[model samples]
Target chain A: MHFHVEVRNLCKDYPGKRALIDVSFGVERGEIFALIGPNGAGKTTLLRILDLLDEPSSGTVLFRGAEVDYSIKDRKDLRRGIGMVFQRTVLFNMSTFDNVAYGLKVRGMSEREIREGVKAALELVRLQGFEGRNALALSGGEAQRVALAQALAIEPELLLLDEPTANLDPRNASIIEEVLSRVNREGKTTIIMSTHNVFQAENLAHRIALLNEGKIERIGAFQDIFERPHRFLSEFARLENVFSGFSKATPEGTSIIDVGNGLHIEAAFERSGSVIVHIPPEDIILSTRPIVSSARNTLEGLVVQISDLGSIVKLKVRSNRDFTAQITKRSFNDMKIGLNSKVFLAFKASSVKMI
Target chain B: MESPFIEEVLSITLLSLRVSGLAVLIGALAGVPIGTILGFKRFRGKRTLMRLMDVALRSFVNTLMGLPPVVVGLVVYLLLSSSGPLGPLRLLYTPTAMILTQLIMVTPIIIGVTMSAVGGVEESIREKALSLGASNWQATWMVLREARMGLLTAIIVAFGAAISEVGGIMMAGGNIRWFTRTLTTAIVTEVELGNFALAISLGIILLTMAFAINLLLTIMQLRGVRG
Candidate 1:
């Protein structure tokens, strides 16, 4: 059997944490493979290892039936054939044309070739006229599209992505998803991506690996992995900002859910007793300080994590419970929010959806 | 406009610029590379030693940045004295000695500031470059390019500190009337002699230089520097 990439008994230990343990998988050539898991479930670590950016503590990774030699001095040649986009958007402080042209320039391409390549890549991402715009000044969606252009400009044999659309607005997310599908179909590039969203996985992958707590819980078709464990896996793994608990209907024509851990979420729908609810990250707003708002849900949270997604900033705020919020990068800077800074999250009751 | 006093002031200002400018130029040439190395490299597989060395280097640079002007002057003066190790070169009590003194004083400022600039952009930029197929040297070059503005800030700050210094140049240059005199030492002399008008005028010239350079810096910042 011919396989594009295969791993056996991979393990990675960092200080007191074991990020991956004896994980084994094989990806066939020209197929979309996905690694789906919740937060802190080793998805990022596995992707990094696959990109050859990090070394496993033990195990062997074979690419194209040859074992990878991490100790080789010419790993540049090996890595040149692979492209990766990180979860947090990263771009050079340069014009979009220059940022997208970086990989080609590093490979000693001629000026004409680099220019043509950049134009084509940006056009692919629907950023035809953004060549002269400063990358840092672009909106979040545009900046992420620029990042995708940078990766696609390289035309790698393998593409790896970490949470590509997890924090994007719906339109931009769908655009990226469409681009991924087109690239896979047209270029026949082997793609590996890690995501916690079941909807995204179900929409893209031909094969799936469900990872949790440093190990693969299951690996197969989506339905094959979740056939029996559907309720348990979907509770926390399928969506962003998901909560489950007993809910009581209020006189204001809404439902208040006691999601435990000193938190109660208000939903627009009227439901009683056991229930599950989800709030899309894009539906929430973040502020450095609290303000009077008509929204039914207002919670003060501590900024635990901040991800710069070009024009937008995605923050993980630990309040009554962990909540994800998105805000414009300008507001994030204006508010001078930093890690551990107190902030507020306000979302309309209608923003919550029953799962 | 061609008065003797005005001619003297012009000469002093020219001397100050020549000496301090040369010193800062040499400092940048030497300090930028050192700062880049310090910013980008770590001793992998030896985390404890890496941290210890990092702390030691930071403390050393901080101490040098805060070193007394007179102390630097004394050290340079002694090194070029007749009986010292560098005595055979006979550079004592010359503009060269003042340049050396200012170079010692400002190189740490340049190194410290440049280190911070390069360090700020190092990790994310390097990883991004490497993941896009750049080699190690190419990745470091990318970080340095990204930090071009910070590097400019370093040069501006170092030049400001070097030009305004008096005690070090006074000791090393000996404030020779037509030979080694600079704007700062001349101002000190004018103030001691109660020439308030000349002293104030010289102060105005110093402020004007700082203001012009800082205006350039402000414009660069307003050009939309994100990091």
Candidate 2:
């Protein structure tokens, strides 16, 4: 099958740092492909190279199975078929109408066409009645919408967004995501976006590439990748409570892992030798006193730190191993948990996954 | 208003306005493009060029900004003198000579201010424009639009400098009555003649003209800022 876009052996090197290292990917026409990674993972650099805004140190980007020519004339022609929205919205210091109309105007579209296209694009972004407002004076969300409208006005064949909702409120973020979905569905504009939000990648992208340290760690459908993650991905996905230990299968078909400092964690699965373990923060129950329960692993530790994360409180417990737990602020206040408070953390054998 | 003195003041004021206005107009027409090009374009060795300009070109322009009007007048005088290279034009001691001298005086000011103004626009604006499908020339035009307020200020400032100058016009124009006697030179002549009252009156009128021109330009700048 002919892919819409193909990136092969792409590498970007700066003076003192490597931003992308031998990155390769493909996007099918009409599919939403997401590049998911943390900050400084070179997501923006890769997106820029795809958008034809920057050149790679060594690589080839093929569109419709044809390698792209980096000449100025060819790049300009290619760029007209691609639209990019930056992480930081860049709107001209003009009215919203003019901002949206700029792309069409530069392409030398007729006045009537420009007017109709700009109006329709703005309507798609749900920013109607904002035509006369100065784009520079717009609120953050409104400015981002205006930028999206500007890109959509040209009706590009491919849409590239670099964290379009990175700084938006939840309402605006959802609105942008909805608009992106609708545009992909209705226009069949192949969409590629970079986002650090794992949930967002799962929600919107038909396929996702987990990127780390300028490399593509894994790329597949969300369910396939998340369900049976690679060792590195398991550690990346379960960001808070990962541990290295040795596991041995017991006679009862259960596994016991020596996770340093004489602490052994019991797991439902049977495994052997050294393994990495993941315990979800939400699964670990915190209590002031030890309780006799069905949970296989009950470790005693001291609350080294407590951080109030708005509605939830994150506690760092240091026992034989360091574990992070998220609890409700109300439960934290009721229990009166403070720094250096003694606590017991409990979880079932099934909760511990050996990667 | 019917007095000879009133007629003399009116003629001198009109002549001054005419010479300085033409000089500023021509200077702006020449300097704006040069400044814009210097401000926006980047090529290989651009940094080296800028470093050279920073150390040499800018210092030269700044030095010209404080150039004594009389020295410029003397240069124009020699150029337009009968025995000089440009003597065939016979422009010496004419209002044209005075205008040329003023033009030279203000062109550097306009160029310097305009260059700085265009430079003040964020580089990202141009990059964003290019990414949005604007061609090189189109992107530059957008930058120029963004720097319009500064450009207007440059014109106003050059106009002020042109109109208030005395030495260049005095040497080049010869202060001929009813032809080339501008406000500043006329005021000097009046003061030398011990006509203190008339000199003071001419000074007031000159100040009023400067105020009016600046006020108009400032209003334009404010409107640009608001938009």
Candidate 3:
């Protein structure tokens, strides 16, 4: 009943900063485990520690019930069982075929065996027939795929990814996600990936670890964690308009939470006492003036900041508290809103999520 | 074309290539691995003793890379002098002595340049290789492969220094006609002896040979890039 890999009280210290703090976790065999967090959360450090590339400042890392021996001279067999894809795609200055064949070749596989392995790996990443192309000459997506193919060519038992899809285009990102799912299901490889993308974790990982400020804040499935409102998670998960407030259940089975600054937020939940909530930026409607509506909350504010994102515009409105409202650029132009314009932010009670 | 001056020029040109080519080849054999090791040494987690050793070794190599030709000539002359340690071999005033002098001059150039080349690609390629199940030696080799063009440039640079040098070969080789004399040494003599025509001709031949060698190596480097 040993976990595939388990870290107990792992810590890593740089000269002036502690990268990881007394972190502990375990992943089951063949499980798609994710370490999700914002930047500087020590996800990369944890992966490097698990990969044996970096020793933890202090702790025990058990791989398949065996404590990793970093001092050992010959750990190729152990290392061959684990593969890591770094956040930066660093392919060798060679043909794609040679880049992918590197692992198999180093393992002393026959040329034919290497060819087959490279072909299979390239096919898995949908980069087949990319053998003769220079890896460095490829586009970012193609190069990342080559990096993936290189790791997959070895077919390791465990795969560690450090933000594999952090900056990829959606099309390439989905392709990598699909490949990871297939590799986990078909190859039976235990996959531990670090990402800040919540939807990706929900879509692929069996469980997620919310890492923050050099420590693992929480670890659970999305459903398991949905009950608890974590401000840290809400912040790093990039959700905006989060407010902590005291709630009282209304007679209508809903609740009204009185946040600070005399702003009371109505939520579609029965939570009492203190709770955290995030209103979707898109859910808030912005108007030139205060207007009456069926929406539960409407705060009058001035547009403090405007971020034009081509199709959509995000305006930070300051009333009693700051609220970010997302609106289509067309809507923004139609309203002729400018800085210091008095605006009304409106959203329904159901739009304020508990976590 | 029927003049015996052509033969003289040919002999000096051939002698220059033989001495410099052999020196560069032997220097690469001895220098590349050392440079690779020096270039890829990591500073983290190493003991103070090891760190000191790395610093000492690097300083030694850096000093050697800038050793002047005349200084190298004097050192090799002392080493191979009659009263010196290697005096028993009687290598003075021979092509072998010239080769040895050039070898000493170029080995550090090769080592220093190669160290830089390997350093450029070391971190990323080494990490990538090890993550791909490469052993320490295998990872080192992968980094070296990635730095191959740099290594080639090192050889070309080393060869240029060796073939163009007149001081070291002149001192160590004594510039003996038809035996130890190279294009560079012969040109020096031709210019000093007031044979401007002969000196200019030898200079052209020397420049041509160097251009051809560099062209060949550069083509190889470009092919590597294309790959």
Candidate 4:
């Protein structure tokens, strides 16, 4: 398999801390890859390093099998094939057409080619008629599209996007995502983006790299990462029903006591000491009272926080052992769950994927 | 009492224009690079240099701004009056002396204002320019282009300051009638000679010049905002 972009043991250090530590990953051609992390997780730093805006302290990045050159003289040829959209969209206070055409102009494209290319790029971003408008006056989403158009006008083989949807409303965010998806589909560009929105990653990324504390804890297919995540990865992914407790033996063979509670939960692990449980938020069923069921695990907890992650409402249920569950907004509304509400959170034996 | 001599009023008015205008031109040529350097470069003693230039230039400007035209004239007179070193150049009592005096007076204002204008080009914008494949010189050019209107306004303000002041002209130019007497000096000489109509006409012309320069600056400020 030909990898369009390859990173080998990339490391970056700032004044007092390591921003990126030995991060290595590769993106196959025409794949959508994600670099997901929190604020200081070095997501943008890695993207910048790959884009050649910044240099790594050590290690190498290869584009299309060639070693990455950090020098401008050597990298200009490489840079010509890579386009980057910054976290904060920047467009010269000129017309959208000029903004999109600038890269082409700088690269010494003929005027006719620039015109055709810019038009096509703007059309791809669904900003066809806005060519005459001042780029500065465009809305957040529109401006982002203009930024994308500028990069697209160059027709780069690799596209690096840094938190492209962080600041937009959901509608605008979706618009950008759709535009990107179309671009990736049509141009077969090897696209890597950093996102705060987990759902956007789920929707767009062929493979997701979960970055935490400047380390790549997990990188896999989106479904694989979501379904069977590493312990820290599950937490970072904010998977529902992640709880840990000690295992104890009973007449039922083996069980675990969720420390905060006196009750025992069935154990799937034979050699369990301190074990962690990952129950998808959607898997947890909320009820007003005790129910007799073969589902095996039932924990009592108080609703601590309800966050609206677009389609899903994340219920932070704090039990004797802290547990989190992902529930639909409809489910949350049906339950009328509010902060400090006493609730019973239940999930089936098969639903709890222990890692 | 009857009105004083008209020629002195004309001469003083003429002297202010000639000296200050010449000073502004020279100051701008000198200050633009200094301001650009101070705004863009970060060295070990940059803050120190900035502070030193700030205190020194501001005090120098204020001193020159406050100095009486006769004192500047007397100083120029003393410097070129044969006894002084290199007085043989005979620069004293010449329009060039007046021009030199005003030029020194206005240099600081031009430097200070132009520095601020260049400084206003945001660092983020600078980085953005660099990321967009701009060379260091290209990035500097972008900053300077974006800050062009502000720089122009600084120049205009410097020009206005240079053209209306009277101190350097009377002392350095010696307010020679019909020859070295610019508007400011001419007005002074005319007022002293009780040439009220001529002095007032020259006053009107000086005020108009100042107004025109200020208007041009205001337009530039607006253009800076629009651009």
Best by TM-score: 3
State in Å the error of residue A87, model 4.
Answer: 1.4
Per residue, candidate 1 scores C-alpha lDDT tens digits across B23-124 of: 999999999998877766443234788788788997898788777889999998889999989999999889999999999999998888888888788486
Give the chain A TM-score for each candidate. 0.69, 0.73, 0.75, 0.74
* Top model number, lDDT: 3
**TM-score: model 3 vs. ground truth:** 0.84
Candidate 1: clashing pairs of residues:
A140-A311
Per-residue lDDT over A72-150 for candidate 4, one digit per residue giving the tens place of the 0 to 100 score = 5434555777888899987775688977887787677899999999999998878889988888888988998888888
Better of 3 and 4 by lDDT: 3
The top-ranked prediction according to DockQ is: 3
Clashes of each: 1, 0, 0, 48
DockQ of each: 0.35, 0.50, 0.68, 0.24
lDDT of 1 by residue, A1-355 (tens): 8689998999999999999999999999889999988888899999888888788999989888989988875467888888898888999998999999999999999999999999999988899999888998998888888888898999988999999887788568777887888899999989999987666676789989988888998899976874444444755475557788899999988999999998888989998999877777778978776857988899998989876654566788998789988777788899899999998889999987776
Model 2, residue B29: C-alpha shift (Å): 2.2
Runs in model 2 with CA error above 4 Å? A73-75, A228-348, B3-7, B41-55
1 or 2, greater by lDDT:
2
lDDT of 2 by residue, A261-334 (tens): 88899999998899888887778999999968999999899999765544467789999889988788799999
RMSD of 2: 5.6
**Candidate 3 lDDT by residue in tens digits, A190-271:** 9999987666776789998988889988899966764454777787776558888899999988999988899898888897
Off by over 4 Å in 3: A240-265, A268-276, A280-355, B1-5, B43-59
lDDT per residue (tens digit) for residues B35-151 in model 2: 786666452133677577665866787677677889999999999999999999999989999999999999888888888888888777776777778887888888988899999
- lDDT for position A42 in model 1: 96
The alpha-carbon lDDT assigned to residue A57 of candidate 2 equals 90
